[model samples]
Target chain A: MPVSAVEVLDARFDAEPDHWPELTARAGLRADWSWPVLAAQAWAARVPQLVTVLHGSEGPTGVVASGFVGPTTRRHRFVGPRRAGGLGGLDVRAPGTSAVPGWWFDTDDGHGGVHRLLAEFLPGIRRELGAGVCAALLRQVPEEALPLLEKRGRLVRKTEPLAHLRAVGDRDAWLATLPRKRRQHLRRLFDTIDDDPTTTVRTGGAVDPTRAAELLRVNLETHRDVPIIPLPQFTGQLTALLARPDVFTIAYTDPRDDTLLALGVLLDHPELPLARHWSALPEDEGGRPGLYFHFYGELMRWLHDTGRPRVSLGKKMVDLKRSMGAEFTDQYAAALPLVGLALLGLP
Target chain B: MKTGIGRDSLRGMVKTGVDALWRTAYRRVVRSAFATVPFYRERWALGGRTEPRLGSGSAEGAVSTEDLVRAAVDLAPLAGGPTGFDPVRGLGGLLPLARPTAGDGLLVALEHPGARPVWDLPRGWRGCLVDAEVDDPALPEVGAALGAGRPVVAVGPDKALDGFTDRVPGGDRVHRVPRRTLDRLDSGPYGVLHDPVLGYLGVLRDCGLWHLDWTRVYARRTRAGLAFTLLRQRSPRLVDALVGGGVPGRVEWCPRHATPVVRTVAG
Candidate 1:
């Protein structure tokens, strides 16, 4: 039988039952979207944070984090990574602008429990905050939360078309699903690595500090257009992530001189693998042409062999992700004033 | 007694509703865009606007698509319109634009006569037109919408219309309107700036934590919708996330016209 009542508790995330890893598993969270991962990212960014657990009559159903940015008097809610629409302190409280945080929920309630939690829990927070928040915003939430939000009358949505890969069978099976042109392109990339003994890819091992440092080095090189958290903060976050058994680094090396040509990071989750970050050396640094292509092919192969279902490259790189058989959606954020939404009695 | 209206049935109903919801709204917008803005005008509207295209790091109308499918999901209409264009107000109009879009549908602001300050659309939504006519005298009416009360979407020109003050003491604003012809067909300067039929929706307060705003979209315009959704079905990450979430619904994209279809999945 299902429990009729659920409770929301404002507590440290490390509380009883809904503990890290354990609750994450129970909630069926993905690495990038989960509270633990997001909190770590937010912490690295030095954002203010708080946690709330949605406990059903039986146990905890969902756990979400509220990251505060801007002045406390006019703070906004932030949910996921800063780049993925998570709020930073600066963008908060610009006149007429509200914020939506990145958030995740447990899989236990079929996400219905998440809605109940939002409906009951969010209002409770409004009163607690005192000055009162204008509205709650969520970005890049999947179908799970979308439908639940749709049930509300005033829903604002923007699809985020993300790049992902699904493994039906081993490498060959995966390639077969791609467009013939794309398949041919990828085949050549994979064949180039296979045929050239000089270049090799490595996976399935803990990343030592040295390798982690190299990953950061390459990251700075390629992600100029995108934002990177402060190095010390990122390094700290990377060390914690590397400590996890499920997270691993993928490194491509030039065999002749053993130079680190390109590096990518993958966070293994029960649902699918998450491509957290990656960077490659410039040509002079031994970054060979087609290294990105080769690494992705190799990564797909590994996912197939390991029975991992899919991989998320996060946001951006639309055309490239599309050619690799990826679909995209938009992410939207809305602000509904607490006093009005409740008083007006609208969804 | 057990009813036929089980969770699966409810899921089916919602999926059907969602399918109609996105496509219906999309078609209307696309139809409106194609009919209202002439090809020559799109160039003018496309120019002068400078917000890095809305999605995936591309500028709006920056990378043009030749594929028929990509044309259907074109977001240029939404992104480059006016800086002040708010989807919040437009969101309500979507249901009434097409048949079968569920919810308490919205009433077009024009439906009401008189130089009214705002139109009270369905579901407590307010619509405001920011144009030359707004006077200091109408500040209260404009302020009422901008004031901390209900969700309002105000549309206007590059500047806060000649007379209206854009400042709202307590509103979650998302933009600055720039000049552009969003609706050439309508003799008026209907560029997105002249409209706030879309405004900011507030943050969602929580039990212990507060969450800010969130919105969802199918595809940014000029991207191939059918191809993308088709690829989604084959995607393991998507399949797992969708199936794992246990929402009994599927988005069936029509490959030919590249349309949206909401399907109810069996539990």
Candidate 2:
């Protein structure tokens, strides 16, 4: 018998150590997907019933990424990843697909084997879901997977805009680019507080874990009036980041009164040149004077002064962020074909 | 020696006067009810037909304090009940005279002789009541004149009622009240009694108002000290955050005399 077979199993993180690595290899080998990072992210999300495993014959050939059923209301119906400008990507419409599945493989040799492996395994999982499965939404899908998914269901293309900011040279150089009026406003703001004998902006090392937790609590409370999906696992991830030295926390305070008006945590990814997991005090609290804005500004200045290349001012606040001279980046998702569909459509 | 004793006596008298003034300031409330108000008089007359002793149990055989007190207690059920505000014909007995439309979307107009017509309507999907106090008595009469149908009233402001009336049978009708009479009822010393009763009735008219959409309300109150009855509703995470003793996102404290203030996590 020919040794051509692909197996799909729903496995947990503890069940398979090499599962993530295998998936990444296959994604890179056949479709340029990043499955490894995605698996880590999914694990971090604590999404129960994570449908993932290694697939191949005899040995691992590719990784399969899947998640539980997630519902979207009429309000959040528009939420999904999409292609924008020239950036080709997939929008995870099914409400639970990962942005970066981090599937990587050595494609230097050939694509036939890996493509066959993915085509065979994708449908097997869909069949397993059977009538229960409606449609699969994916984002940042590579071009190769498009032909396969098109055979399975309708592909609605859309464009999603994402904004980003790049930290230029020292703080002054970054500030120099701002319109003179804005720069003057910033200067007056800094000077107004600087002159106040009681007010002080303190720059320091990693945020005290206790204080970081407090900032998170405040951030959540400030938004209590607004409706949003709760992220229960965020605290654990935040705590983990706090434990690392690379993570920096800054506080704006009235030193005389020993009152902390605002605080922020910036996760410095030196290799990636972006600040990850950045959140601050909500703006209604006098923004800069309120501590969150002040701390964010101080943190940006520190990064610039320390020769850090760039910072990722993670999502939202588009207009204000762009005014501060931050550039933008695009995120993507993709869909894969089910085995039966590919086999039926094979020419 | 006698003069010193007299001075001490005078001081004691001043102290007693001051105490009386303080007590009156804190505990005294001026309460008045419309005595000549046509609605009360007419309602009382109707009530007297069944109960001959209506409004006669107290001094001067007028609607006495005791009658007012009894009416207050009996009026509780009239708030948003199945049988509209049962027309109380006698002083203390309530009679189910007319059956108002009983639907979630139906609006009711409380017509008072010589007072602005009060329309108690449903407030969107939230189940609360939004009250529009139109000075025009014609408005309530228009609504009352409305047969069993949905009618849209074009509400405009003018000293003289200037809206054109087009009646569509089986359409919602706009109830109306006479202007001069509604003005008298809405004003005068008796308004004190009328306002609270109207507010209470309005509260009852909308069932959701009593509960106050507890989900969002309780979520808002989780951080505050407002008391609420916790029924077996879907447990929102906000309640969990409040009772579970986790770190609060923000702590808001409103002093009795000062403005409300919020302290964020960074503060």
Candidate 3:
């Protein structure tokens, strides 16, 4: 019985309703990430994009930030968002696209006309994209959205467990919410970090592209063997991420040499601040024992003290995340329009 | 009217005669086009269309920068539309066409990735100066250029750079394509097309072309005569089948384009 028009926008920060943070605050939204504005501009400077926003009768509704991604051998396919960068699962959908952290929108855990918005959203982007829809592979979509997609009768969905802490009351209350073992372990971490005169905790600062790049290199080198984003793109993208007023970095540094031991980036939205990316010298720069435990301790403490709701830790490393007393939910992925289609992950 | 007895003079006289003949044919066709179709009529009334200016020494049809730009503006409307304007269609069966003057930039459009390798360009019109679609068999080079974060842009597959940029010669760094690659892309794989308004829209240095999408290319008797359409296929061999005859023609540089999108994030 919803007959209102759904609007598609350019998804830029300066677009309608003017500013992003104010829009989120006004809507009493659940989770909306800030990377789209940052990454879209940075990426647009280098690639072709077909990003769009979904709007209903009330203010802003959903967002789909997509880009042309593929080898020129065939028509480039449009890819959706990813888990590591996005705050995860909004409501908008672009044509032939669904990625981790697929959309960002305002809905009571799936009460909005979100499904209907996607119904109207595809054709618009397809016309703008000037090509056929290959497939929309959305990973880690919210559990709330599953029933809606299931009712449509054409989609492939898989569920995976996602863990994170949704803080309540104070730091003590949050700690109490965790199991005794995790609470004690986390408390011991803070005490050790505090006891170290040589190690100091620094918070409320921006991530430097130079140091951020170095930190990212440390993480990627430890994880895989792929070449990182070249300095220009890396810096441009990092600079955009850093420019957000709500974004801040926390670092464990050696007061002796003034080098970052471990650094974590937190994106502050109305609902929660996500630990978007974090890296450090391996095992505390191959020397320190407490820095790894220290980064998260301070992160949780900061979120609690600042009266924030929670923090999305990240994908994978489940065993470790679980030990920290994080509540876990199953992340569902669905390939849309063309259901049952095997999805190829972004390279 | 002087049958000057010298061989040089005789060559000039033949050239003049051939020029007059081709020009007359060109005018007759275009005139019929404008008078018969509303699309061409409106296009002529507004400005230039690629007439392939005849009145040449070799009777070779060619275009100048002024003419190319003029024609581009003239045919802008037909660039994007599902049906050619007006229902009447023209196969434009075989006609003399002017060779496009090699401008500062050349555009290459084909289905084959690395299609640029098969293209032979005039010295001034090199692939390095082109702003083409993301297709090229020389993808390694394209990928390398992209990886290096060069000034490459991803445009629609249908777009090709016209004699458009003034980015001074020798001012920019370019990865030069060898002549050998263009050699592989040309040869027998060519098909000739003569559009009612744009003249010979297909690539080829000469005429005697075949399999032109005459019905779709010309809209009047064809569709509102307000638009024109030329089809593009993935295989060069398709051109032969579509042409249905063994006549030879070179590749036509298509100028119609959709907006180009640059890839900010690498896959």
Give the number of the best model, judged by lDDT. 1
Name the better of 2 and 3 by lDDT. 3
Model 1 local distance difference test score: 0.42
List runs of model 1 lying over 4 Å from the truth: A1-18, A30-42, A72-114, A142-159, A210-214, A217-233, A256-258, A329-331, B1-267
lDDT by residue (B74-163, candidate 1, tens digit) is 222211232121323322323222222233321222212233443224464444443344333434564554444433333443344322
DockQ of 3: 0.01
Give the candidate order by descending lDDT: 1, 3, 2
B55-106, model 2: which lDDT tens digit per residue? 2322212332223322331111111112122211110100011112334222
Question: Chain A TM-score per candidate?
Answer: 0.73, 0.58, 0.72
Per-residue CA lDDT of candidate 3, range A1-347, in tens? 23244343433222333645675456433222343433333222222333455556765565555443333311111122211121112222322112235455565435233363345444445444433444454555667666666644446466546666677655566677778888898788778779888787888865555566456656654554322221111333455567767777887777888777777777675554577667777763554675666676677778777877777775557787777656677666565552222232111
Model 1 Cα RMSD, 1 decimal? 27.6
Per-residue lDDT of model 2, residues A1-347, tens digit only: 12244343322233345555464343432111223322222333322233333344556544444443434212212112211112121113211222222233323214322243344434444444453344344543444454444543444343233444556665566668888876776666666766777666666544444345434545554444433343322222344445544546666655665555566555444523333333454446433453434444575687776666665564456677677776654543334333344445641
Give lDDT for model 2.
0.34
The regions of model 2 sitting more than 4 angstroms off are: A1-66, A70-134, A140-152, A157-159, A190-214, A217-234, A251-260, A282-299, A302-308, A331-340, A343-347, B1-267
Q: Could you tell me the TM-score of candidate 2?
A: 0.40
**Candidate 3 stretches greater than 4 Å from native:** A1-49, A55-59, A70-100, A104-114, A151-155, A168-184, A223-233, A284-287, A338-347, B1-267
